[model samples]
Target: MVSRRAFLRGLFGSFLAALAMLIGLPLSYKWRKRMSPTRHSMPETRSGAIPLPYPRIRGEMSLEEAIAYRRSIRDYLDEPITLEELAQVLWAAQGVTETRYGFRAAPSAGATYPLEVYVVVAPRGVVLPSHDFLEPGSYRYVPQSHSLLIVRQGDLQEPLYRAALEQEWVLNAPVNIVIAAVYERTTRRYGERGIRYVHMEVGHVGQNIYLQATALGLATVAVGAFVDEEVQRIIGAGPHVHPLYIMPLAKPLEPYRVSKEELIGYIESHRKERR
Candidate 1:
């Protein structure tokens, strides 16, 4: 028979182990549930919303390669980009990265995500593998569902081109990505400082688009000189959503490739000219 004191000590140890199990199991389950990736089924096409193809996580070009090759290409071939390429580019701009927290590809101030992305596709601008083209119109990117909501039913390229100060690239490029922002989203939370934050976020998004386009062997030029009201109206955006950047994207007519040494020499030559 065990001593009474020893028996009580063993009983206390058992009680402690039981208490730990009771507390730990529920916590572990909750953590596992949180950590697991949630799957979202493709939503039914309704309300003029078209689901975009799932974006690929991996690409042929490395991040470094993409950065090195990135150029502000203005001239493009008279050809259309594929639907998949358009999807990838849009995903890079503002696609949701984390489902649990509703995080996006680019960082945002307090996760305000004030920016909205719209694509103005020219007639036969984006082609599918089957040679079918995405209907030419302005479509709003909805990140949560990874889909495009049709804003307008016909080509707004001429109006958009005119609004973008009649830039040839704007008229020629097969697709124009219009980045707009609703100030209230960020401003309401961060006060006046949020305006700066929104600008910073747009820059981040622009860089993402540039790099992604580079990776896809495409070309784009960010056009900032535009009548804000005109672009807003052309893209069918509400008054609250102000236009920020218009990036015209397409296949470059001639790829602008330059090595580091070539760039350095060019800079030096420019400096000499100034001197």
Candidate 2:
């Protein structure tokens, strides 16, 4: 028969082992999660550049005012959005704010910014610094450089409109900001859970753009209902980058300040169009 002291010691040892596992397993997992790669394999430094340094200045509108002014605008005036406005909106979406940590306007899980921003410009001229620079085409937003890298050269409005299920707003808008993600960038850090994180990050980025647009006196609407593959193709994104959100932006034809009756009338018209 075992001694009483030995039996109690054995039980204590077993309890310690179980407790160790409960603590050690999570600690080990956290270590791995902390060190695992979170960045995309894309080059850290690129060649082509636009250098949007003008957006360094902050906007005048308060966050509360922007939230109140934000709307899902579909009708737009026949006007081209200035390059400065584009820069501001892009900066709001994902532009690098903290150079030290490469922190952007939107937060990412584990700082693994998996989202890639792309801009599609209308055929009309976009004036920058008193002169037109960008031709009508799809351009990738290089967050690191805070500039656009031209992906393809030519008008892409028709293809984008087709891909977006013939959304007239897409066709009419001077710029369409496409948010795409490379899941592997996040998944490498959090496995399947990272996909959800990427989705959450997109929402944050989209809201930033909406608020920025409102503050700038521009109008925009986030478009998610689209043929995914078609949008990817239109934007010339690689196979790894999955398109997530499309935001069509433009100058609103109607005044931002509308009476309650006018808002109701607009809603009724929208309902009729949906039928």
| Model 2 C-alpha lDDT per residue in residues 1-275, reported as the tens digit of each score | 33556445434644664484456545533553354344211222234345664574566877777886788999999888888889889999999887655678898776767899999988763656646545677877867667776666568998999999998999999899999998886787679999999999999999999999999999999999899999999998879989999999899987465456776898999999999
Clashes of 1: 0
> Tens-digit lDDT track for model 1 on 1-275?
43566445434644664485456546543553354354212243633357888999999988977888898999899999987899999999999898755578999876767899999999889987667777777878878778886666577899999999899999999999999998887787679999999999999999999999999999998889999999999888889999999999999988767688987898999999998
TM-score of each: 0.79, 0.76
Clashes (backbone N, CA, C under 3 Å), per candidate, total 0, 0
TM-score of 2: 0.76
Using lDDT, give the best candidate's number. Answer: 1
